[model samples]
Target: MKAAVHSRYGPPAVVRVAEVDQPSVGDKDLLVRVHATTVNRTDCAYRAARPFFVRALTGLARPRRAVLGTEYAGVVEAVGGGVTSFSVGDRVFGYNEGAFGTHAEYLAVPHDGPVATMPAGMTFEEAAPGTEGAHYAMAFIRVARVRAGQEVLVYGATGAIGSAAVQFLKHHGATVTAVCGTAQLELVKGLGADRVVDHTAQDFTRDERRYDAVFDAVGMSTFGRCRRLLRRASSGR
Candidate 1:
């Protein structure tokens, strides 16, 4: 199999697609023929060994895993003996963290890992990049304690995290206010946002309405800027 590999951490040019040995499938593994994958910030951080401290986990000297992808969407070419939840030819997509190795022609994912069957009618390309964004969105939403009927604002609503956040927030019964560039207003609205704000023409922070929570999925808003938008704590207690 061929993979985008980097022996030493550096720029994008350091990674080169090269022939590498295929992963051996253990009893609980699914050998997938990868059809699509995503390159996100996590991949870039690992590839460049950014923040310096990631080396403590990835490697002090060099990356322990040469393949740099963290997510994959593919069809199962084979399944290990112990695997039952999935079978050969099943379409699946999954996410991994430290155990990154999806940027390749083929990948072996654990049967009980973060993997799941692709949603009905969804293409591999759409499902490939959805895992991480949905995972992170769920984490952040839980931390925010979003609830039904509460007003919430999501900045950068066009990107992965923000887009998923909008849908997740809506599913939680929160009234979502999605902020994005002019081009993505309709798309964000289609994601179930109750209202869409084009950040280019207007200032969302200056809106008279307050929210139960404000999610800055793209790191474009500081807490200080969004503080005024959040509803104040009840004083009765």
Candidate 2:
């Protein structure tokens, strides 16, 4: 098998395609022939070994895991005897920020992990990029306990996570106020946001509408800045 591998942490130049031993299938593993994958921020963060903590996952001296990718879409070439959820020839796509091996010709994943059957009529390229961003977005929405009819504000609404957040919030029946740059205002609106704010032209925190949750997708805002925009709790019932 061949993979985009890096021995040391640095920029894009550090990685190269190299032959590597294919992963052995575990009792619950499925060996996928990767058809599509993505180069995402997580991969770059790990490659650069930025923020220091990333070293804990990769390596302190150098990268322990040479292949760096977290998302993939492909066909199951083989399935472990214990794996019944998926079988050989199943079209699947999924991601694991902790599992960085998808930028390769083959990837082995636990059948019960984040892996799922690809949606009908969707290509591998389309499904491959869906998991990483949507996973983070869904996590935030779940943590916030966002519900139908709730008002939620999303900052950095044009980003991968933010774009998914807008659509997910709308799917949950929330009234979303999305904040993005001027160029992405229409794109965010097309994602089903009830209102869109041009952060480049005006500050979104100054908006009048109180929100049930403020999702800073790009990690640019602090709690102190958006606290005033939150709906205050009151004694009721």
Candidates in order: C-alpha RMSD to true structure:
2.6, 2.7
For model 2, the superposed segments whose C-alpha errors exceed 4 Å read 234-237
Segments of candidate 1 deviating more than 4 angstroms:
234-237
lDDT of model 2, residue 195: 93
For residue 109, give model 2's deviation from the true position in Å.
Answer: 0.5
What would the TM-scores of all predictions be?
0.92, 0.94
Candidate 2, 94-211: lDDT as tens digits: 9967778999999999888999999899999999999888999999988888889888999989889999999999999999999998988788889999999999899888998888
Native RMSD of candidate 1 (Å)? 2.6
